[model samples]
Target chain A: MNWDAIFTSLRLASLTSLILLVLSLPLAAWLAFSRWRWRFLIESVVALPLVLPPTVLGFYILTAMGSRSPLGRWYADLIGSPLPFTFEGLVFASVIYSLPFAVQPMASSFAAVDRNLVEVSWTLGISRLATFFRLILPSAKNGVVTALVLTFAHTIGEFGVVLMVGGNIEGVTRTVSIDIYDQVQDLNYAAASRTSLVLLLFSFIVLAVVYSLNRNSPLWPTLRKR
Target chain B: MADAEKTMTNGARPLQVSIKRNFAGRFLLDVSFNVGAGPGTVLVIFGPSGSGKTTVLRCLAGLESVDEGTIRFDGEAWSDTAGKVFVIPQKRNIGYVPQDYALFPHLSVRGNVEYGIPRARREAEGPWIDRLLLILGLTDLQQALPGSISGGQRQRVALARALARRPRLLLLDEPLSALDAPTRSVLRFELRRQLKQLDVPAVLVTHDWEDALGLGDQMIVLSGGRLLQSGSPLDILTKPENLAVASVVGVETVVPGRRVRRERGIAQVQVAGLNLWAADIDQPGDEVYVCIRAENVTLEIGSATKSSARNHLPGVLLGVVAAGPLMRVKVDVGFHVDALVTRQAVEDLDLKVGSPVGISIKATAIHLIPR
Candidate 1:
């Protein structure tokens, strides 16, 4: 097994899901509750990655982070290095690619909460920010967990975006999906099959955990009975 | 106007609201009323389901904004469209119990009640919260979740949570409408007693007239998003200001009449070509509507001569319907007049359909509103 590729994927997925969690909480809240006139435009922009081809999204992101672009130039000025073909660039691309996975579930769950509970919180002299933390976050716990898990798994399975922006650097940006493609290119069928099996087993376990968390029945019903 | 000046000079700040809100294709809510400040002062916004009673309560709580006019509570401008002054609901310091009670499902009853207190003040305010729970009878269920409690218990938890914060004003929207009939009737008195003991001025909204009469010190009748009348509950029940108010107050007999002459303190009005005497008013209009409650009309078997009632009309009884403990007798005396009497009275008078009877109404019992 390609252990270095596995560890890099874990690091990138963990960091990307953490950043998305912090960013998506308030964004999803605003999407669920704001009464702004043009809110659908923002919603569409956030959901663009869900339907668009990953290569197309990667191409735009690549163009935006090229040496000639303003963001690319500002980052190089600050960190004394370019943004393309690095682990940081891969993290950035994966975050954009998996944003809809993080936001949609959280927003829907927040919207499903009884609005009177929120209004009652405000009437009790609790500020909106405090109410969000005290009432809304706890109430939407399952959706929040779902968002984190999906974002992590989606980032781990990303292939096209990482290859486009981060390139095939061995330890820097070569994640498990890119390692599988490299093994197949080299005619190493045994290594490729082994990696694919691990991925399939890991995805099944992740989904099992998600479904169990969402179920109303206890996961270990026999133990519960005892 | 004189009463307004009197309330203002006593150093008490009454809640004064005058607002106009448009719900696009729904209706235009235009109302203005005042709630006196003191313990045991409850102002009920009484109306039917679609009559914008909740809208008025929401505007008062700052949950819903008004499109025009102002809402001033305790001399502070909570909302003023012309001046662009609006206080958000968080800063309003209000205790609001919504229609469903809206207990926090994720928290224990104690946690729900302790939610409004600041984290730094929780330790200090623990005793106060305990007192609130004891008063509302939620002490035994403090550790239970809202879902595990009964409906009445959940309502008490909601009330305890609202009162824990010691808000400046309390707002309740159909507080007892979600319970069963038996529970609702029992909670009606319990809620009124709690509000009086808490000594906080409240604004309550309800479609049920019994809630309005049993719980309110002052009542405002609303219909079709318009303010029909504002007065004491007894005053509004006995003397509504207009036809709409009469209908909302459930006054059963309202007939159009024309004033024929005025003598001393009484006016002789002709209704269905029959003369009826009412207390005189100074209004110049001759056209009016005479309103009477069914309970105020007395039925006689024959021509009764020993009573002091001013108007007596002899007609045939049209219908007799059993209504709870009383019998509703309808008599066609020029116009149909309804009288509510006990079944024993009905049996003693031998009241049957197509039988001759005399209906007597006191001059003071007849209320006149301009047509």
Candidate 2:
């Protein structure tokens, strides 16, 4: 309810979404266009975090960086400490936790762009890089927007990953989800209700805007007709 | 290497699509022929379905990759498998119009026409597009989308788009077969005039002889992926190299026969079913195939009495095949021989399948060659 908490949640959600877009881009593009026979393996891995319980993912991240594995030990030496109980670790865990919500819509949307349009653009002497930026990404705008809003909202409402990794460290790692949990644990029901309402309202507003814009889109129906 | 060298020697000038493609398990298309386009030169690639006419165009346009060949347009090697050189389609400076009229559906008539020019030249596309629109009678439809226009309009739009490219060569794949009769005729005339006025070479593909006769200055007939004959329309039509081309060039019937005797210019050949006389038989050869149109074999309904035509054979009316206004009457005189007769003749004779009739062939009507 306070201005600082609201700002913190907004910043955290924005940072989480930015990280998600960067991490999911190649995976999304690959899923959209790759013809390799073993593509299902990459697809299943991207999709695994979605169906797997958020607690399960958080628990794995906790163990993976708990000085047990060689990667964790090496990372610990580089940072002079282990990854668990850090804000960066929470962001890293949340990116995987929110990947399906970010990338599935993008891949499907990119897949729906007309191959003829792409081929013609290429044959028209347009460079491949221009074709990707001007044609592919713009044409797949709906997917990008869907990815952005879903990742942002999903990250804002995160509880399990942050809890398992950040261990409720205040200010640095206590996001809106952890804040609400702390409020409820202290019997501060009013503060918890306010945070929950804001998150619910934020998600509803983002989803409503995305859905409304999609209704007026010409590219989406053309894809459906095809 | 030998094929490429021979083709270069044959087509050393401008017609340089010297290629042979083997689409494994599908079919083989090895066509090596050359005829350039200028004010009075338009090459017609006439063939049956799946004869690789369109593939030839694509190879030249640098669209379909060839297994072995050199596609040189204006001395630039677009593709040379032996030389391992290739130029992409955009840089080739060719205007390709596909069979389906592959115009950008999203663009307006003017937009489609103005597609080929560089962005810097776009501002000056006005006069060009205007001239093309005026030529195609599409001045008013410039703002209209392709879907909202007629088939003839779409054809003109696609043609204008190709023409606006100002390429060295033009490629059209059955541009008129999709239109109605009247529109086809109108577009045919307009397209021929435009091609001539442009003074650039063209390769037009079609399965229809009418297109060849109406538009082509250099007509090439093809069948089953081989060049049957190539020459001017009249030259190819009247003197096809073999039976395969004679049939394609409107010679309706091909009868396998042997030359028997000759007197002056006229020669007699004993065929399996009938005797035929042909003029100008320089070398009718040991065995020959006489090609004749049914209309050339004139039909006369008689009382078994008066007729001066020596080639008359008694036969029963087989059936009637009427396409549009023209009628083709098939007659079976013991052997199956078609007699293309006028509708008026059918009426006058009261001709039907069981109707008894007679067929006559003038000596000049028979175009004969080796089988």
Candidate 3:
């Protein structure tokens, strides 16, 4: 099996997870607290990626980032490289494809936080920024961990979107899923089985660690005898 | 103006709050009151649920802004809707203890208490923190998180955290409402003592009249988001403005009656097909409600004796309910009259359902409110 494809997949997943986490924190907070009339519009738009066919989403991203598009031309002018079939392009597509995975759980967790906590913090003379870091983030740790794990796993296992947008380039864009696809197409059953087994086992282990941590989380130590 | 001057000269910065807001076209709250800012002075806003009591506290704390009018805390405008002066809650320097305590579940007791204290000045206020922990009886549990502690401890931690910042005004919204009965009883007195020691202007909102009567030096009654009345607790209890105020204050029984005669500021009324007399009952021929407290009704087993309490009615016992130290004995004298007597009284008098008993209420105890 190709090790460069495995390393590229890991790099893409980690970068996508970290960037999505940072970008979605404020978005999830807004979704949780805002009473705007048009809030559901933004929510449905974010969740669109979850239901759309991965190739369809990739096709849209590819169209948006084509050299003919204004953003694609501007970015291509700003940078020396063209947009399609690059590691950066793959990471950007993965972020959008996995946006709902990072945002939904985060929004739910933030909504679960007692509104009284925020109000009391404000009354105690704590600023909103301080309260978010000091109170909200700590309370919503489980959801944040879930978001990270899901985003990383989802990005690692992505095939159709990366194939459509990143085009299965040998070392740069070919991830483990794309490698397994190529091995299967080349009629190398042994290599395809090995890579697929590795992906399945890795996803299981990550999910197991997350679930075990959730079971022992400080917020709900259900096994402890009071 | 004179009251404000007197309070200011005595080193007490009186809080003058007057504000109005239209809440979703359901209720319009218009309130104006003043409470002297000093130790041992608690201004309680007492009303039932959805009566705008908590809203008043929130408005003062800057958690909720008012639509019109100004809120002056020691002559500094915290909110002026027309003048465009709106101070955020963080800048108001107010301590607010909500109903759920709202302790930080992630932080240790000490960490939560010190959260509001300026970190740069935390070391200098170490003794103050120690004093608070000791006074609140939380020294041993200082390192524990809120979830690991009892309800009362969480409440103390929330209060300590609020006080750590040395707020100018304190707002307590039903601080003891979430606790069990025994804890609530114990914390009520302890909270009152601590609030007195803090010596800051406070506005406590509670739906429970017991909290208001026990902790409030002065009280305001709110119903349907309007200020019904404001006075001493005893005054509000003895003379509510209308039937709504009387009901919210938890007057045991209110009997609609027509005044039959008036003599020496005392009026005799026909109520529920029975004759009753009440003092401070001027304007004969006026419709009124005779509000009687259950605690004021005394139970007797036999015939009426020569006593100062002139309003005695013979009735049969309807039912008996043991409520803590007192037993609520419902007596039927044409209408049901609840008399809160001791459990020993029930046992001593052998009073049960259908047993003959006498309910004696003093004429002066009857609070007459115009219908």
Candidate 4:
């Protein structure tokens, strides 16, 4: 059943989601609260992944991470390896591919926080940065969870970016989606269906968890009585 | 600029503000005033909606910037557009309570109160936090989240949160506007008492006249984003400087009149073909507006009783409306005049629409502003 590919996919999705979460926190905060005149330009760029085809994004990312580029050369010098075709390259591509999934929910929720709460915090002698941590982050708990879940699931289901950036290496870069394609190409219908069923079930459960967290009522009705 | 520096040296008042800011869509805010020098002083900015009262308070708190002028608090310039100095709100050391109270829904009452204290000093500030909760009568509900508390309780939590910082100044924007009517009245006196006990200099913005009169030691009337008048609360209520100030301060009856004659510090003015006597002013103009507050008017049935009031006009009752504890009785005696009488008085006098009524207004009760 290609358990090696399954484990690799799990590792890549976990690392990619974690990296996206850390990078998206400050980026989403700036997008939500900044009054800069050119802020819409940044917002448009962040939202580009939502509309752009994965192959188009992967093409740019692959070109940028090639050994000839400055970023590629610097990373190769530091890590003694070129970026493309490695598991690290796959993680980087997934982060950019799923950027909107992590950022949109968080930015919208942060923007929805009562403006008065933030101003009151400032008036109470809390700095803006402190207020972001103390007040805003806690208020946006549901959105943060949604962002993590969506990013993790999106990274798992990704195909085009992963294949373009990280070539099909059985244990290193062949994720569940890539493994499914490899199985079908080899006319191994039984293996492909098993993997497809797992992906479908996983996606469904992730969505159910997100919707339940965001519902107005508590997920367990009995707990609300107290 | 020279004059601003001169006032800075005096330092008699604790807060001084003179700012001009232009907003989009033709709204221009230009105001200048100084609050009292003493602690426990409360200066209220009173106006109707869209009058820039909240904007003025926001400017004072450093939440909103001004296009011109300076804001001086306790001899330090908080905002000076000319000098290019603008202190952020965190460094301003000010407590601010917004209209809605804005309690953190996720935090308990105690958590909200303790939010302003630095984490390093939170342990040292524990006793103070307890005292604040006790003083505000929130000790019993210290662990209750804001969403579970009543409106009045939420307000106290917001106050506690702001006060925990031990700020030099307090800014409240329509502090009581969010509560229901009954809760608002009960909290009004309680808020006044708390402010006095705390002895903090505060600036409050409110559209409600009752809030201004009940809480302020000094009042500034604002309308159309301009400072119309500044004086004691009673003075601004009884004697507004112009028609705009008169309307903003809720003077119920204002009619244009011409001064016919002056005698013994009393001027006889003809308003709506009715001769009215008002306290005389030597403004050298005949045209004036006769402004009379509804509360200052007394309504009588049948023959007028003997009183010091100089103007008594026989009229027909036009309408009766309930206004809190009072009944607002409108009468027409050549011109419409409003009088606020107790509900019991309404029943005793059997006042009803289309009934004969008499309105007696004192000479001093009538204010005259040159048209």
Q: What share of the true interface contacts does each candidate keep?
A: 0.95, 0.12, 0.93, 0.93
DockQ of 4: 0.79
Predictions ranked by TM-score, top down? 3, 4, 1, 2
lDDT of 2 at A176: 80
Query: In order of the candidates, what TM-score does chain B achieve?
Result: 0.88, 0.89, 0.92, 0.92
Model 3 per-residue lDDT tens digits across residues B1-371 = 45445666667777878899997887899888776766557888999998988888888888888999889887799999889999999998988898888888888999998988878988999999999888888999989988898888888998888888888877888988889898888899998898888777678899887888889878889988888888888889878878888888988888888888888877888898899988765543479888899999999878787788979899999999987778998999998888898888889999879989998999988878887
Model 1, which residues run further than 4 Å from truth? A184-190, A217-226, B1-12, B258-270, B273-286, B295-334, B337-365
- Superior by DockQ: candidate 2 or candidate 3: 3
For residues B96-151, could you state the per-residue lDDT of candidate 2 as single tens digits? Answer: 77777866655788977876666798778778778878988889999998879999
What's the TM-score of every candidate structure? Answer: 0.86, 0.78, 0.93, 0.92
CAPRI band for model 2:
acceptable
The docking category that best describes candidate 4 is medium
Q: Give the per-residue lDDT digits (tens) of candidate 3, residues A1-226.
A: 7888999999999999999999999999999889999999999999999999998999999998989899889889999778899999999999999999999888888888888888888877789988888889898888788889889999998988999999988999999999998898999999999888888898899888888887766322223222
What TM-score does chain A reach in every model? 0.93, 0.88, 0.94, 0.92
Residue A3 of model 1 has an lDDT of: 88
Off by over 4 Å in 4: A209-226, B1-13, B260-265, B343-352
TM-score of 3: 0.93
Q: Residue by residue across B119-214, what tens digits does model 1's lDDT show? A: 899999999998999899988899999989899998888888888889888888998898988898899999999999987778899988789988
Identify the candidate with maximal DockQ.
3
